[model samples]
Target chain A: MKLYDYVRSSAAYRVRIALNLKGLVYESVPISLLEGTQLGEDYRALNPTGLVPSLAIDDQGSGEGILGQSLAIIEYLDECYPEPALMPATPLKRARTRALALQIACDIHPLNNLRVLKYLTGELELSEEQKTTWYHHWLKQGLSPLEQQLGGDDSRYCCGDTPTLADICLVPQLYNARRFKLDLTPYARLVAIDQACNQLTEFRQAHPDQQPSHPGENLTRR
Target chain B: MKLYDYVRSSAAYRVRIALNLKGLVYESVPISLLEGTQLGEDYRALNPTGLVPSLAIDDQGSGEGILGQSLAIIEYLDECYPEPALMPATPLKRARTRALALQIACDIHPLNNLRVLKYLTGELELSEEQKTTWYHHWLKQGLSPLEQQLGGDDSRYCCGDTPTLADICLVPQLYNARRFKLDLTPYARLVAIDQACNQLTEFRQAHPDQQPSHPGENLTRR
Candidate 1:
């Protein structure tokens, strides 16, 4: 297996954590979003959306194909290798877990994504202050509800005692939130989950700082 | 089953199509997003994110247990009633199906969502023209790539001959594109898939105009 990844991308970070949790060994092929390499013709052929974290599976000893979307990729990994399941066995539990994941992946992440921010600052000509405000506004809209969803549970992870899809989505979003300097004190359960996840080798190894594309500087901050 | 829905919500529309496809009888409890009904305290308790298209399952003779997120709801329905599968049988194909769905559900729709549009025009005070531009910009970013992904496939639907999660996503987006007056000539395959999907009774019944909240008016324009 091979993963086309970008260091700072939250979507790519999700796939990285899933891979680590499944104990799958794969080569990381960095596709730098900052360098405009993802927009290149060659990379676009592999992934039409020109996004990071496309997993190329080598099933049948011959390459099957590449898959995109972080949640889809994570679910694929879970289905293909089911030992330590990333989703619950029951239908309703699975739905709840996926709902939590989608709350972050769909509602939250896209609003403040890199391209959206670029458009705000570049095309919209938003000042740095306005851009920061935009980022914070969307981040809070997403995190407040997410904080509530994860609050009532007394589990070790976001959905349960073990890490599920919700936790996979949460760690990366929190990582991005910290980078944007969003106040983390209000989201107690999410913060606790982040702390718990980072304690594990799977989550620790997949940190953005540990990626090949990291610039030898710590991107994560308290 | 009872579905908390809004007529124009792409997320809700996806679940409606999934339910119709599965031949499940569900009562539509209209949650009028435009009327600010989703912001109510009671609805928020049922759905922490305060989003539409929450499927409340009435299993075990109990009145309800709410399930949120369209993909999660569809997956739950697929799991509980598996005759007409919304996802593919194999992992790789399922991954492909989900990737297409997420590309729209996560990347495309959210950026141009009703709430996002309101935020743009209300909070940011963007002009109507600027808001339209923002909507078109994100829509194009998503659809152009999706067209490329679907172009090579000769499948009747987005993933294959059978209607899958991708088809469910495509129909609503195309419906939305028409509403926004986006030039649809470019995405022939997608347009064709939308046409094919609408021909089925399942997709026909799930049309936004057929929903209870639709004010007996055609929202889509050529």
Candidate 2:
């Protein structure tokens, strides 16, 4: 298997976490969003969306296919290899878990992604402060509801004691939230959940800093 | 079942379509987003998120519980009553349908929703033209990916001949796209899929204007 990935993309970071959690080995083929590799004709042919973290599965039995959408990829992985299940057994529980994941993945993170922010300042002409406000608005809007859900019934992980789909989505959003310097004090439950999840080797290895092409170390300005 | 819904909300429209398709008789309780009815104390008690299309199922034998998140609500409805299944049988196919749905629901519609657009122009101070551009940008970004998937499959519906999760999601989004005056020519495959699905009676009854709160007789705007 080969993962076409970008380190800073939270969606890609999610697939990386899932692969690590399952102990699956894959070759990394870097597709730098910053360097415009995603816009190249070769990459575009592979993915019409020109999105990263496209998994090229080369298993002999199943034949070849390129899978997109991080949640869909994770769900497919869970179905194809169900040892350490990312989703729970019951239908209601699965819906809740998926809903929790979507709360962050859909509601919060998409508004603040690289392309979206670039569009806001570049094409839409939003000022820098306005752009920051746009980012924080979604962060606050979604985190409040998510924190309530997590604080209500959650213990260690989002659904239960073990990490599941909700936790898979939570870690990546928190990674993005911290980068934007958004205040997360109000979401104490989420903050606590994120802190615990980060300690595990699966998550630690999949951290943005641990990526083979991490640009944060040498080039990032303080 | 009682549905707290608004006539024009795309999220609410998705739930309405699912209910009609499943042949569930749900009582209508309109909470107008335009009039700020969702923020009222009565509605907020039912849904802390203060969003509409919150379904409360009241069965004589089974107890009532509030279901939120249009996709979650639809999935739960499918689970509770499984005769006319919305999602596909196989996990892979189901993931494909859902990935297509999320491409519209998560990536496109949220960005163009009333609240977000209001924030964009009001708080972020984007001009009217910029807001229009912002709306079209996401609509184009999301629909183009969907076009490729739908074009490849060429199913009568998004997955197969029968309407599934993808159609349920697509119809509502296409409704929003049309409302925004977006150029649908770029998404020819998606437009074809939506056109075929919208011709159905289930999709017809679920149209926004047919809802309890729509202002005019015809759902189509002048």
Candidate 3:
């Protein structure tokens, strides 16, 4: 198996955490979103959407094996490798877990993705201050409600005691929020959950700074 | 089951379609997005995110049955009602179907959702023309590759012969695209799939126009 990956993409980071939690080993092919490597003909042919973290499985040499969209890919992984399931056991809890993930994935992440940011600053010609405002506005809009949802819950993670898909999604989004310097104090529960998840080796291993292609890595190796 | 819904919301429309496809009956309580009904205390108490299409399910006296997020709600319904599966049989095929759906849900729909458009025009002070341009830009960026991905596929639906989650997502997005006057010619494959899905009673009954609170409905009755 091989994953077309980018170190800093929240979507890719979600997949990396899931893989690590499942104890799965796969080759990580770095796709440089910064350099527009995802837009090249070769990557587009591999993933028509031109997105990172496409999981390519051999599947015993039968049918389409490449998958895109982080949540979908993570679900696929969970279904195939049921041990340490990323979803809760019951359907209702599963739905809640998924809803939490989608709240971040659909509502928050897309608005702040690299391409959309480029559209704002490049095509729309918004100032950097305006762009930062756009970023914080979405973070607050999404995370404020999330903070309320998680306010009273005392689960070790987002959905349950173990790291489920919700936690997989939340950690990376918090990482992005901190990178943008959004005030994290408002999301105290989320911060506590992030701190708990980071204590796990799987989550720590999936951090952007730990990836091969992160800017902090050695230039020669990268 | 009760659905907190808005007639023109793509997310609510998706849940409506899923309910219809699963042959499940639901009470549609309209939350008018235009009138800021979703922002009211009543709606937020049910769904803290202030989003439409929150499914309130009485799960045999189980806890936490209210499900938010269209995909999560649909998946819960699919799991509970397995007669007509919204996902494909195999894990890989299910991944493909979900990837197709998420391509629209995360990438296209959120960018063009009501709040984002409001942000574009109200906060950023973009002209109507600029908003339209922004809408079309994302449509092309998202749908062009989707068209190519679906180009040679002969399935009656997006993932297979029967309508899956992919088709459920596609119909509403195309509805929004046409509303924005996007050139459907560039997305011939998606347009064709949309036409095919619309032929079914399930899809047709789920239309925004068919909702109780649709603007075309008599205001007094509403």
Runs of candidate 2 with Cα error greater than 4 angstroms are A58-62, A213-222, B58-63, B213-222
**Residues A78-100, candidate 1, lDDT per residue (tens digit)?**
99899799998788789889999
Poorest 10 consecutive residues of model 3 chain A by lDDT?
A: A213-222
Q: Which ten residues in a row have the lowest lDDT in candidate 3 chain B?
A: B213-222
lDDT digits (tens) for residues A70-135 of candidate 2: 888898888878979888876667777877887777778777888888887888776889888888
Q: List the candidate numbers ranked by TM-score, top first.
A: 3, 1, 2
**Of the candidates numbered 1 and 3, which has the greater lDDT value?**
3
> In model 3, which runs have C-alpha deviations exceeding 4 angstroms?
A60-64, A213-222, B213-222
* DockQ values per model: 0.87, 0.51, 0.90
Query: Tens digit of lDDT per residue, candidate 2, span B122-159?
Result: 87777889888888888888888778767876778888
Question: Which residue runs does candidate 1 get wrong by more than 4 Å?
Answer: A213-222, B60-63, B213-222
Q: If you score just chain A, what TM-score does every candidate get?
A: 0.95, 0.95, 0.95
Q: How close to the true structure is residue B193 of candidate 3, measured as C-alpha lDDT? A: 91
Per-residue lDDT of candidate 1, residues B1-222 (tens digit):
888888888899999999999998888888778778899999999887888988889755434688999999989898989979888988888988999999999899999998988888887788999988999998999999999999987889998889999999999999899889899999999999999999999999998878754554335421
* lDDT of candidate 3 over A78-175, digit per residue (tens): 99899998998888889989999999999999999999999999999999999999999999999999999988779888987999999999999999
When 1 and 2 are scored with DockQ, the better candidate is 1
